[model samples]
Target: MDRFIECWNGLDDPRTGNAALHDFHEILAIAMCAVLCGGQGSVDMGLFAKSKEPFLRGFLRLENGVPSHDTFSRLFRMLDTEQFRAAFQRFMAGFSEQCEGVVAIDGKVLRRSFDSASGKSPLHMVAAWGCEQRLVLAQIATDAKSNEITAVPKLLEMLRLKGTIVTADALNCQRAIAQQIVDQGGDYALALKGNQGTLHDDVVLFLDDPASKAITAEPVVEADHGRIETRTATVATDIAWLNKDHHWPGLAAVGKVERLRETAGKTTSQTAYYLLSAPLTPERFNEVVRSHWGVENRLHWRLDVVMNEDQDRSRLGNGPHNLAVLRHMAINVMQKDGEKGSLRGKFKRASWDEAYLARLLSLF
Candidate 1:
């Protein structure tokens, strides 16, 4: 736990005078442990601290005794989100090696974090998830979904993107975002859509042309959950003519993936286009594109379904965003755990077994 303390010790406490009874790092440490063991909000943190006071005191010095739920809530409300996020990044830097492979950037909403009386919308967060590492590299909270365009660049600035391929949905396929990715020594596979205006139109027109005859990969087929799916990836590297017209930054190739799925005898098909900074093989393109969904399937879904994130109603001040960071930290720790079981199982084990919880804390 010394490693964990070293990273978070840099955070400046917002509390002052009599309000600063508990040590900032100790409260943060307790909160981290609570979330890792299935604690949801301030109440859970307080209960967990009280119940596990002995286990907590092994590493933390609770000179002021356990803090109340109100203390946990107030600290998060007043905490500077930017500093907490930076501390989270610092902690992850020490916890893992250099980030590599597909780093998927996406946004998720804290659906219930809005305050009806205060007229606030749900908190929207843009997160960069390292697919190979299965950890959140960095995140930024935006006021709305449309702000993701602005929020994404800020999120990118916090990451070490060298030698990584960043992927994002059509909403984030802006020219500046693409340029930023290339300028940072990273490649991009941004989805193409109508939002790109003429660029999207030209790519679709060219790829759809019969004479284009793009190189196609052997169709991949999979069957599961009472459904059969087939995906075929096609790539066209002869984009010099297109580049001459658009001059997109680092433009090397364009790609198309056609997916056909039959579920309950109902057939559905989707065709997605991409702007690539490098010419990737159809197979490699398939891998990169498929890995992008890991941010949703592995991170977003788990947060909402497994961790009950959306149901959390912490709608005061910085509470929502700060708690979101804690959730990400908990996930990173648990994902790094080598124990053999599902995440849900790990939470149960951690909650019931203090030894196992200590083992997880030691990962940092």
Candidate 2:
């Protein structure tokens, strides 16, 4: 995407010259592509590029062109990240159609890089991943030291939310964020926690008030990790936390859980409380609200465990944003490729198939 790279630069070409990669562009792109295909580190990128020399030489202007690991680092360090992320949003827009249901909004830190002395900062990015659409709709950077409270709303504004439900964690369970989602023509299922004293207390009180029962005999049967399990659960309450002065929006019902788990001839149980963003209906609220954790497990877990993304120090200049975008794009592409279910499997597919890997980046 030479044209894309140029467009992302977003500055008029000076009469002096066009800001081109001067052949180094292709190398960097190729190298970045290799990295996304499971290059472990700078050295891994170099080796991957070398291994593909014969194939890369065909489409890339590799003649008289070679980039050391430092070249990759310095080049990414020079990129205008915000401009690029905007361009990336546009590039990804065509692929990220609003196919259906609720979207998940969350933030994460590249924690290991927080203290890196290489001038790379730890990153806090708010991402809106459409579970139903199977793609990331938008992502924005939060200040490395702060929460994503402000950034989350901004990121949602960039999205096309015709029939979407935005789900976030406890930190985002405020009236403003919830109202923002409604204002954007979307619904929210934000988790309630101790962060909001009044709301948390109110929900707890409603659940504990001896009458709110949200789930009844909700039995979930599924097979996972070579095991078959059945879960029968209920939601009943005893109010000890709700206050008279607190206001809850779209607050359907507050309740507690009673989960009985049976597996391998052993039966265990659990109980807890939850605050609902929508009306309290056993089928709808129980399924969607409870399923919110699936987003964290399915996406973020894979990002860390398989892609090793959170461990990287790609935070200089726009390096953090660019790398984050690339990583998300890679996951989306891999998910669509039909060969892999997990991030590691996708990387394996890319590493095994150079042509397939090329196809992955060509979309960029």
Candidate 3:
């Protein structure tokens, strides 16, 4: 993978031959190392790369390559981040195809650069995640014209959704999207909200109408945080939505949800409505919903707080986007490299270990 990134990098012309940094391999490796070193900008990446040469040399054979901070910044500032992302996804094609469950469709704004006075080039990406495999399958940029709802179906077309359950928040609960997921041989578990005027009204009314009982199921889960004891649970799934055709092509079932929770000494909870393409009892629906939040806590929150992703503004052409992708790749590698330990600490270990870098590049 290191060689591949290096070779891919060399594909670009640096305009100047004798510059301190004209090679992509060295630049790419440095940028990647910077991410691994907790560096959040191109300058930081270049410094990190120089600071850890002995360790990097053990993995990347940069016989006589050293890119300056400006070189690193300029190269990334011009390189096609979207193209690089596509290439990386191609590299992980085999691993992505093995995904077995819900392929979540969502979008997140690179908040820090939303107002970069240089015109509206802020990147908005529609990402498809293999929820079951815990891997990001693919991502497409939503240009200045569209939103997640508009970008989803087009993105789904690029993926092979066979036997998968594509889940999303209320924003994606559209008729066309449901049809698209079913058409691709996949199921869906879209959240039901007020956006679907009639449908939402019906689900609410139906659940409230006393005669809505259809199935009975319950699940009890316990969790503790040293001093506090908490138990979370779900107690409802009975509804007619799960049995009706509802006009959804491959639709098998749909339902409502009731969540009960007791934390510390106080207990509070709310009911959330859901539409599922599978008759997975109430117990199962709750599991998927809870797991979905892991994306927020594990990936999003960690990136923002630990990796400091949301704060950086490396405002070059494709620089920011490319850097974001590199950071995610670094996260995945760090997670897979068991001995590296926590996300915050992985950069240190990655900077010191050569075999680890080789191992990361070799992984899917």
TM-score of every model versus the real structure = 0.97, 0.80, 0.84
- The regions of model 1 sitting more than 4 angstroms off are none
- lDDT per model, in order? 0.93, 0.64, 0.67
Point out where model 2 deviates above 4 Å. Answer: 1-21, 24-28, 40-42, 116-121, 213-217, 221-245, 248-277, 362-364
Displacement of residue 199 (Cα, Å) in model 3 is 0.3
lDDT of 3: 0.67
Q: Against the true structure, candidate 1 has what lDDT?
A: 0.93
Which 10-residue window of candidate 3 scores lowest in summed lDDT? Answer: 226-235
lDDT, candidate 1, residue 286?
91
Off by over 4 Å in 3: 1-3, 6-21, 58-65, 143-146, 224-246, 264-267, 338-340
Q: What does candidate 2's lDDT look like per residue over 229-319, in tens digits?
A: 5544344322232323555554434544445566676777765555544444555555665555655776778778887877775555655
lDDT of 2 at 66: 55
Which candidate number maximizes TM-score? 1
Task: Tell me which residue pairs clash in candidate 3.
Answer: 242-254
Q: What is the Cα-based lDDT of residue 363 in candidate 2?
A: 62
CA RMSD for every model?
A: 1.2, 4.4, 3.6
lDDT of 2 at 8: 48
Q: Top lDDT: which candidate number?
A: 1
lDDT of 1 by residue, 248-287 (tens): 9999999999999999868999999999998899999999
